[model samples]
Target chain A: MRHGKYRFLLGALTLPLALYGLLVLWPYLQAFYLAFTDWTGVTSEVNLIGIDNFTRMWSDPLFLAALRHNGLMLLAVPLAVIVVALGLAAGTRGTRVYRVVYFFPQLLSVAIIAVLWQFVYTPNSGLLNGLLTGLGLDSWRHSWLAEPDLALWCVIAVLIWSAIGFYVVLFAAAMESVPADIMEAAAIDGAGELTVFRRITLPLIWDSVQVAWIYLGILALDGFALVQIMTVGPGGPDNSTEVMGLTLYRTAFTYSKFGYASAMGVAIFFLSLTLAVLMLKFTRREKVELA
Target chain B: MKTIRHTVLTLWALVFTVPLLWAFMSSVKTDAEIFDSPWQPPATPHFENWSRAWEQASIGRYLGNTVIVVGGSLTLTMLLGALVAYCLARYEFPGNRTIYYTLVAGMLFPVFLALVPLFFVVKQLGMLNTYHGLILVYTAYALPFTVFFLHGFFRALPGAVAEAAFIDGASHAGVFWRVMLPMARPGMVSIGIFNFLGLWNQYLLPKALNTDPDDYVITQGLAALATSRGASSDWSGLFAGLVIAILPVLIAYVFFQRQIRAGLTAGAVR
Candidate 1:
């Protein structure tokens, strides 16, 4: 009877198990295999030119530019988004209207956000430039998305602005997770609000902050949709906004160099994995202060 | 202090809403009015733009396609994710840890990295450009995160319920579908909302697989409208398309703000 029951359980679980393995594992494994071969994605003729893809990646100026763009985004986008969100969260607590308004952008798709910002960054008749010209600062107005020197920075600004709502909501959620009694106690002990936040609140929600940092780091490297829509994959004027994600995408689909793109994807895969592991390890090392 | 807090949040919220409000208002404005007064509200609101956007851009077709893809993917993913979560949370089988860890590992792997291989795989299956194909890919991609989120909720449930069901001469499947699932509605709802939004907002997967214009989802269609064919001169029509694209998402957000927020937080936390 026990044997029959075990057999039934195995039979029931088999379909789901196979589906998961086939769906997730199979594609990932195939990706690894294709990364090493010169598969142009047209034919089954796979040439195993060992390490050629990787060697080519080292010399690819496009890949390097992509790395640089992502690096700059890493430095700028999350920092800007989070800092503004932190300020918003800190300033607005226990207010219904505040919650509703802060989450407005979370509803927008990347295409919509890109289009909205495209209007804002329009050169002559743009709301931004119109304001600049209206303020008698015509000299200060410049082509925002077209200027190569400032283009990536412009894209970064759009990304930061569009992503602010999510972080504001996240930070607000994390801030709420901090115990009220601890906050009140800090206040009673003659600590200012800023002091209370810096000392008491920050430590308790360190895990949540780490979560945000990790998520943003992944987003930083994997950015594509907005960059593609805003800057057009080649990163206009001179590959200025060519981040790694866009580069890999164009390499695969646009250029049809499937092997080269897969190789780039693998590099990105390891890059994200390394950062995630390092962040998790770093967080794990910190002592959890249980009050 | 309350007044100060309210004022600051309201101001920031206004800043957040301005672009969306602008897009929405511009969608309804006449072309001449859009150029004449970019910031001002239309003297008489033109709701016809919504219909125009729908008809001109063939947004109806795109919306229908999006619904098919998102709905198909959401149902399949939630069922599969909940099953896997149940297995991981309740049963003790050999290789259970291996299965759980492997699923979690897929979460860290970015979708971009798998696009090429996934495309070829879909092509091999002769499913590209079909709703079934796209739905399958989405379900597979979304499964890991859904499983991860649902696992937490399932684990949090008391074991006695399942134990009682098992002792009462119920089959394992009966216990899962009848006893466990009904009780896991909140978790399932949260996962369902997350999958809906993610699949709805998706651009890259559909773009990569479906080159046929008929199969284009709203995101891909809106992008193609704005950049490809519509890049000729005036952007009024393209902006109209953009507004059409985001309207459904906005409506859903307005209606289900709590569920959406909780869904997002649950995915991230797990």
Candidate 2:
């Protein structure tokens, strides 16, 4: 019976495992190796140039710029998302109607969202500028996407707009799980609303908040597709919104430097892995002490 | 406090819906009207704009392509995902924990990490820009979450039901196909909607692996329309393409708002 059971287990797992390994894991392993080599994607030859690509990255201005943008987003996106999502989740009354509307952005593809927002940010006929001009605040309108100082912030705004609803629902779900009586009790005890939220609601949902930080952090790191379709140069006027994924992508396909691009991928991989572990460790330690 | 909350929520909802509403309205305006009166209702709704985007822009072609690819990938993902998830959930064997963790670990990998080599991989298989190639890649990419979600579902099912099926002389395979699979139907439907939306909305995969215009998916096609310089003057047509791309998702979200919400949030909250 045990033998037959093992047979069924192995038999069932074989095909899915093989597909996942071949298509996902194998390539990831190869990327780590490829990072060390100098293989122009066009070439049949792969020369192992150890750490050269990694060393070169520090001197590359574009790579440094990309890293700076990603880092800024890694800090800004999650903080902004949590604030708005937490507010909405805590404040909203009719969740049914609100959830549907708020989550609408999550339904559309990044491509569709990019295209839609591109129109919204259009200089002359755009929704933002049109509304501003209509309101007699004409000077407030600068080319939202075209201006170098503001372009990356514009991209960040879109990212925040698209992401907030999901986290709102996430935080709301966590909030809902807290006993209603606890909140009621806090109110009856002369606790202010802010005090109750801070002393009570916030503590209960800290875990979800932690998870959200990691999720949104990773998302912030990969602003590739959104930045690609949204910006004029994609990375754009003065490279203000250049991201790590975009840098890696252009390196491989546009410049055909597969090895150097693989090194960028490896860097992103480490960044992501570190973020995940660090969040878990940081949050888990506090989680235990809270209990 | 109550009034303040209501006011804030109302204002935020406007922020969410107004851009979409504006986009749909702009879709029907003449190109000149789009530039001149961006916020006004069109004098007459140009319904032909939708048809033009559908046929001329070949959004219809791209829609067809998306449906086929999403359908194929969704089916494969569920089948393979269910089988493996069910096993990991129920069976105990050597390396069971290892296999389960390894699959779940794939979720943490940003798809960007794999793109440079993943492109080469699909090309090596001579499968780039082809339907099956994309279907396979999508399935592989989707496995981690699908398995992760369905594993929870399978684990939550009572052990007694499967034990009864076995006593009735159902073989392992028979039990899984007939008894276990049906029992996991709710989980299937949840993750099914989850995967459907995900695979449907996929941008980077198709953008990276399939660039041929004929092979372009919805995202690629609409993106091409949006970015292509020749179509720059056709703002009405471009907005029409945007609205067309949005409508199906909008409709599905309306109909399946409950399942969609529950399906999407289940992983995060759990």
Candidate 3:
């Protein structure tokens, strides 16, 4: 058995490691190098250019717009998702995790969600207008995804709608783990629901909410699928809804400027890393010990 | 309080659930009806929309392709992920922590950072439009989440059973294959179901790597259906295609709600 032990260990580790290296690690390293070079994605001849792409990115309006949109989502979507998900999850302790609300959107492909919402936002004969017309609120009708000012918000709405259910369940699970006696004691002290939530429920489930912040923050930064498939011009109604992921994709694939796209990808990587670290730093709290 | 809560929950349910119900309902409405009366029940249910989307729009072929690739990759991810987790968990060998952290670190970086090189890597291998290529890459990318999630599960298992198996002259591989593997079924099933949903809905990898039209997976095919001719004249059929894409996942969620939820919220658990 000892003789075969080393062989078994080596055998087990080899394939997964090799696959990981070839597909994940190698490409990641190459992406950094390619970000600094001029690889047209069609040409075999590559030459290092030394941060030219990064310098160009600061001046490029499209990349800046994409960065700003990601930042906006970074602020807006996580707050909305956390607020709504926590509201829905409040007091629903031990609720079974089978809500169709989450599964419907969470399980479906982005393509489906995009197409579904496209019809919903269609200006003339779409669901939103039809609902408005039915409610005699004809003054409210507009092309939801076509209006530049309204388009990013529309995408953010979908992002929040699709995301809230999972966190609701996650927070509810956390709430369940909070001892019944603590909640009961809070209630016995004549605390209102809001007060109890603020003083007790919030701190007890602070860890889960923090996890949610980081997850939703990263998710907000990667709205490629929603923005790509749903928005007008695929990235525009004046580029209002363009995101970093879509920018990287279009920069690479549409323009075939792989090196430039690689630069955008690296920028996104550092942005997310910073976002994660910031969330961890700012959201840190003194541990709440239950008596 | 209960009344208010129920009211909010009910309204919340309607807000989120109605769109899917509407998508399914609209799938059966004529294109004109869908346009004219978005909220009404269809005047006449167009049962043929499903068939049209399945046959003329080629959603059937794409679904078949998705099943093959997702199925192939899920199996490989589970087997390899479990093996890696087991070896790392149960043994102390050189480079163990390094390999574990290396695999776990794969999760932190966004896939977009790797997309450019990964595309060329596959292209250089002459596997740009191949099933095996996508399957291998899918397994490779999925390794991180699987190993990370299963690592804790493997660590928690009792050591006595494997010890007893070893005393009975079971080879190390035999003890793992027989004793440890069966004990890890719950973890495997949870992650497996989650992996299925994720890989099933995967659009980025396929959209980037597999551009050949003949190899469209579910998301790619449905995306094409939206952009091209079917989107203009055949709205109901497009809705049908959307429903067909989502229905299997909804069904799976109903049955495996426990495991699926566990898989999704596992990171939040610890």
Candidate 4:
């Protein structure tokens, strides 16, 4: 019976496992190996350069700038998204209508979202500037995606806008799971709404919050599609909006530096792994089991 | 206080809706109208814009391509994922846990890392720019989530029926095909819808693997339309393309909002 069971399992697993190993795992392992080589992506000859790509990355201005942009996004986007989502989620407890409305942005592709925002951020005829000028606040209407200092922030703002909705829905679901009676009891015990949220609600949904953080951090790290589509030169206006994903893409595809790009990929992999681990560790809290 | 919360919620909801509504409105407006009054009702709605975008800009081809790729990928992913998930969930064999963990860990592999090598791999297999290449990659990528979701679902089901089926002289394959799979339909539907939305909206994989203009997916096609030089003159058409691209997903979300929400939050909360 044991042998028969193993045979059945092997029969079921063989095809899927083969496909996965070849297409997914094999490529991943190849990428890790290629990171140390001097493969230009044009020719078949890939010479092992032994961390030269990694060493060069330390002094590469473009790479460093891209890393810095991703760093900023990693911190800013998640923080802004979580705070607003938490507020909206907490405030709209009993309602279902707002949840649907807020989640609308999450439905569209990042490409579509970027295109929509392109029109919104257009200089003269864009909705944002038009609204600002119509309100007699022309001074506040700088070119949203043009100024280098403000371009990445513009990208981050779009990131936050598109993302906050999903987390609002996510956190709302988590918040809703916390019994209303507990909140009411806290309210009766002279706790303000903020205090009740801080003292009771936040702790209970810490797991969800941790997951949201990791997800958002991964997203922030990969602001590639948005930056590729929305920004002036595709992570331009002086490369202020450059991100690691975009950098890796340009390195591999544009410059044809496969080895160097693979090194960037390795860096991103480690960075993402570290961030995920650190978030899981730091967000650890006493398990609040509700009866 | 309650009113304040409602107001804030309403305002934020507007923030999400108005941009999309604005894009939709702009899709029907003439270029002059879009530029002249950015927020006004179009004096004469150019309904032909959609037709023009469909016919002139090659968005129709892109849409067709996307449907094929997404459809093929979803079917394969669901089928293969169900097989793997059922095996891992139902049978306890040597290396079962190892296989399951490895599959789950594939979810965290940053796709961009494998871009260059995967490109070469596809090229070597003579599959670049083909539907098969994109479909296969998407299936492989979606396996982790599909297997993960379905594994949990299969575990939750009562195994007595499968046991009875086996005892009744049904082959293991017969029990799996006729009983276990039918019982896991809800899980399949949820994950299927999720995968449909995801694969449809996928930008990066298509961008990297399939660069042929003729074979571009909807996202790629829409992106090309937006960024191309002639975009300035075809603003209404561009808006129309955006609408056409987004409509299916939006409709799906509206109809299957509950399932979509459940699928999205499934991994997060638990």
Best by DockQ: 2
Chain A in model 4: its TM-score? Answer: 0.96
Error of 2 at B229 (Å): 2.8
Checking candidate 3 for backbone clashes, the offending pairs are none
Can you write out model 2's per-residue Cα lDDT over A153-269, one digit (the tens) per residue?
999999999999998888888888888898898899999999999988888889889989889989989999888988988798789989999999999889989999999999999
Off by over 4 Å in 2: A1-7, A281-291, B230-232
lDDT by residue (B72-149, candidate 1, tens digit) is 988888887888788788778788788888888888777777889888888888999999988888888888888888
Q: If scored against the real structure, what TM-score would every candidate get?
A: 0.94, 0.97, 0.97, 0.97
State fnat for each of the candidate structures: 0.49, 0.79, 0.70, 0.68
Residue-wise lDDT of candidate 2 within B1-270, one digit each (tens)?
677778889899999999999999999999988888889999999989999989988889999999999999999999999999999999877898999999999987778778889999999999999999999999999999999999999999888988888888788988899988999998899889889989998998898899899999999999887877464467888888889899998888878888888888876765
Pairwise TM-score winner, candidates 1 and 3:
3
- Model 4 compared with the native: what TM-score? 0.97
Local accuracy of candidate 4 as per-residue lDDT tens digits, A249-270:
9999999899999999999999
Candidate 2, number of clashes: 0
Q: 1 or 2: which has the higher TM-score?
A: 2
Residue B202 shift from truth in candidate 3, angstroms = 0.6
- Model 4 regions more than 4 Å off: A1-7, B230-232
TM-score of chain B of each: 0.93, 0.96, 0.96, 0.96
Error of 4 at B143 (Å): 0.4
| Candidate 1 residue pairs in clash (backbone atoms < 3 Å) | none
The interface root-mean-square deviation of each model, in the order shown, is 2.2, 1.4, 1.7, 1.5
Query: What DockQ class does candidate 2 belong to?
Result: medium
TM-score of the A-chain for all models: 0.90, 0.94, 0.95, 0.96
